[model samples]
Target chain A: MKNLNRRDFLKTAALGAAAATLGTKSAKASEKLLSEDRLGVLVDTSVCVGCRHCEWACRLAHNMPSPALDYYSNPTVLKEFRRPDKTALTVVNEFENDKNPNLPIHVKIQCMHCDHPACVSACIVGALTKNEDGSVVWDDGKCIGCRYCMVACQFQIPTYDYDVSIDPHIRKCDFCTERRKEGQLPACVNICPNEALVFGKRSEILRIAKNRTKRKPDIYINHIYGESEIGGTSWVYIAGKDFNELKMPPLGKNPAPGISEAIQHGIFAYFVPPVTLYALLGTIMWVTKRRNESADKDKHDHHSDSHDHHSDSGRDPYRTSGHNTYRDSGHNTYRDSGLSTDKDTKGDNL
Target chain B: MKPAPVKHRFFTPGVIILAVLALNGLIFLAVRFISGLGAVTNLDNNTPWGLWIGVDVAAGVALAAGGFTSAALGHVIHREHYHAIVRPALLTALLGYTFVAFAVCVDIGRFYYIWHPLIMWNGNSALFEVGICVMIYMTVLYIEFLPIVTEKFMGKVNLPGFLETFNEPADKLLRMLNSGLSKTMFIFIIAGVVLSTLHQSSLGTLMVIAGQKMHPLWQTPVLPLLFLLSAIAVGFPMIIFESLIASRSFKMKPEMKILSRLGSMVAPILGVYLAVKIGDMFISDDFKYILKFDVPAWMFMAETGLIIIAFVLFLSKETTRSPGRLFLASSLVIAGVLLNRINNFIVAYKPLYDPVAYFPSFGEISVTVGCIALLVLIYRAVVIYFPVISHK
Candidate 1:
């Protein structure tokens, strides 16, 4: 017993060392893959006027259908606050303060384009893709239209056209990928007359956001929204009020996608579970087969014992006399019916 | 009478209702394509996703987890005690995923581009894995049900001359096929188990991106654990309920002896889930929210209450043994999972500076209902045609 215990302990120790070594190697590889040069956007809420140019530009740029409600006709629309839909990629909403009685603040709502996007992580079909250039995009061809991305997104930026006859796709802001490729700004950024939105590299935007805070400490909130929220977003904001006051959700510094992925990847990192499960199943089937064999043997032994008893009665159990044959035929009838397990037993022969 | 082996096939009540729903659903889908998502859905810029997503697809996948969990514990673990309950669990999971696929078809804006993910490889996105897994998993589920098809159609049947050529000594052929299929069953089962685990947990991770928008009661690093555990907790109970209904309806022997045993095993997992949930809240100081009587706080209480009720119902051997009680308990467990998902994704989630709220349009609700109705129709068809029940 002692020897067996020592051998098992040594075996476990060796396996542990191997597992640790493999784990470190994978971690090192992952570290190398993590991108450092993240891109982002800067929004200064202090200098903003409520103009719906972003909405118009977004629709036109994407070739999406025009909205039924005229942008100019609905002056209070901003006051009502709008959300980005399948058609409308971005919207500007007004927030008024009853106490201060200042001009209502305008906040633009669009896809935040997170540094590590949850939609990207939630997409199983690779429909939602994150580009190396820091823009999170979508590919409809691969999408089975399971809107998991919409459910998983913290910003809830992606919208689906549920009314489409056959194949509806997820619609949202894509950081104006085409325009960015042509060295142009996103439609929203290009159309913003007040310069409320600033488009640049994430590092540059972070610098600009910080400089604004340093220049006028009292005018803007110190923190930048999306800087570290959900592991950061391309669209960062400096708001007039606390983030929660704006109804901004509280998020952790780490990517929400990462937390869930860690557990998912950990348990099923490779084929550990599948292999283990098979080995266990095979063992059970093997055991059940053995039990069946033993049950068969027990029945065979009982039949032989019963045959000895019939022969000892001197009844000529194996004879072919007419009376004997008649009884033999009767006994064989029951045996042929699959109702008798004991092939050699006779109740009256003894 | 053997019920003519097949039921009357032309325009059955179930089929008629599905046909009507399909017509309406197709029309709504048309409007969505022509006018874009804004035309039909109650979704907005602030609330980007709606019921088409949170309820139909994401929650649907979570519910379908019954198949993998039951298969793992029953077959892989060599628990003959659980064998009686496995088939029904797989059936529920199979139907759930079929519904998910239907929901997905109705949920996206540009439906034509749905195949892009399979053609492309975007490993970075969690959505990528979710989509691929769901697609592959659905196919796997259908394959898993093939034996039922074989047992019903091929077993104890006379083949025509042409057909008989393929199945000389058909019994031997079937036995061979069964054995061959069994030998490699582990591969499919393993893939199914792994994929289910990935996507169910990914469902929780999907919400982590929302950050501050989500209520504190739900937001945590332990979301994956919570989702997977909840899925497993609901799995056995789902199987039990299905078995009870099928047996009672079909006038067959109730597999209560085995089902109750499985329920006993599942009860502790529920207890562990609740403990971990509370423990996380306490450790993170997020438990403070539970003290408040606000919507978020009340929702948390209600969610936990339902789960605890399910746990209590299952824990007692007497209640677990009773079919009615077992069914009710499992239903509650499933309800608890749905409510938790809705709370995390919709009810408790609030976007910044967006006063606009969402309520699905009549058309949106209709489409979702249609998808669910289709699942029922398919389930009915499969059950009637396949020998899902054991032949004693």
Candidate 2:
């Protein structure tokens, strides 16, 4: 029985090891997804006019609250790094490109809609889901409003509607899923007079971006902001200046969600191992119960047979002496220690 | 054994104080639910988690470590002498989880959707595991406590037909349930151990996923290991602390020998924990981050200092046995543990470009305090009424 217990322990440990390996593998598998015909946008800093038209159109299209700053305002909000809030669906921030300070690089900040979104993975209630079309959508009904998605989002795109006390919602740029589903351009794309924000099939967007960069080497930077950034955001950007100056993190091609998903699954995959362990433990407990009962019955029979000769024996000698020694060594060891005192007191003595 | 008649001796000053605290807490919770999180919390975009997660959930769980201690020794380690303490420990675990669930409700902005876990199951979510495990474990704990319920409440109904049921069949029912639960208890005990292990570690893991948002001092791969070890190290001591206070209030003798033995076990584990922490820092080459003159760095030092003080105090052979000294050490360990959790989840997590910082409002604090008070009241009510503390 002891050997069998050890073997079971080993099997469980082995299963745990296998589960961990499987978890890591699943994480890698999800990461290995390649999108060849992906659509993206390329924003060239050389041509941006710091127009708030895209922001206006985004708000109008999403039915979000208009910003306090009218479209004709001085565009001073562009000076600071600003993101789309609950009210504002998109915001254009101006970054001073050292290559051409006279022409301020206006970067439109919104949800990147990464190929693998952290928000989708972070949401335990299935409130957030990333579509194959690459648009990340939110289902408020399933949402616990935990705001974990907001916390997990690397770009800090998701915002909470804190004012809505009755039914709060997390607001984020959805890449204009409604517009795209209707085969129409995003509001921001449709309003871009300079052709600065382009929305198309991700594959075509990549092609156009590459073609533009190749044709005008001196005008545009060699990099496409979303082509491989953070495992490829749906909306791509073509930049004349460095992306970092525009507050774009130096993200890797590996999406933030993929690695996190891997780690999350790796840790939680141990769930199955425990259930199997519980079954084994239950069996052991059952067997022990039966053994204990049988042992008690045998002791009772032995006592009855020995009653004439050994009437002095107590009802439960096992409780008083035999088991008690092994039962509580911590207190018993401290109270009446054997190894420290007498060597001969080891014969099941209490 | 036939459960003795429950003695009702209310109007004690302790009960009154507890009652007042409970009332105050309820009012505070009302304010929290109505006024929104900003009205009563120090939470911000940078630090999404704060005092509630730190003290209420993390610290509360550690204090309830009695469950793990009793269950592990009695069930896993298979030392039958400590069996008497298991039920109380299980009770503490149940109450602690109940408080944690309440904290989650109040702390979460759209707490109404918390039921989303059961309806919308996301297999990949850590919070899903935490939510599901805690909920199920809470149920299992209550089920474990049912024998106590039967022994106490069922025996007192006094209806003629019901009274007849209590005589022979009731004894059999209790035995069958006890044996059945015992047969099933190992699974839940193991489940509790495993679930607590994962969630406690995941508390640290939750911060790790925050990436650059968290301070370097708190972020490390070994956080899971650290949190789990601390929970284990503090588990038995917390039990000792709770039992000591109960013994004092109930006018019973302290379980000195048991507590002393537990203390000795904890001291070595604390030493090992310290070694692992320092060794992890050294290996990661993140030791310099601890020296930085920043809030995260100072918080780290303070957390380490508290643990060290507790370890040193309890490490002594003489101090381990003294009930008062053991209590002090346990308090420090708990304080250090709480501080570590808070610093990691709240104070240390600083993201760039966050304009606002969060502080739990009076309402938030009230709700948290109230939840704790309720747990205490429940615990007191149980121990006073039931056979929680075994006879001398």
Residue-level lDDT tens digits of model 1 in B47-82:
666777777887788777779887776555544334
Q: Measured by TM-score, how close is model 2 to the native structure?
A: 0.84
**What is the Cα-based lDDT of residue B377 in candidate 2?**
87
Q: Which stretches of candidate 2 lie over 4 Å from their true place?
A: A1-20, A31-35, A67-72, A79-81, A97-101, A207-223, A268-272, A279-350, B1-18, B44-46, B159-184
- How far does residue B34 in candidate 1 sit from its true spot (Å)? 8.3
Instruction: For each candidate in the order shown, give its overall lDDT on alpha carbons.
Output: 0.67, 0.68
Candidate 2 CA-lDDT value: 0.68
Off by over 4 Å in 1: A1-80, A85-113, A127-134, A137-147, A156-205, A224-252, A270-350, B1-66, B81-84, B110-115, B155-176, B189-195, B294-299, B337-348, B351-381
Report the C-alpha displacement of residue A245, candidate 1, in angstroms. 5.2
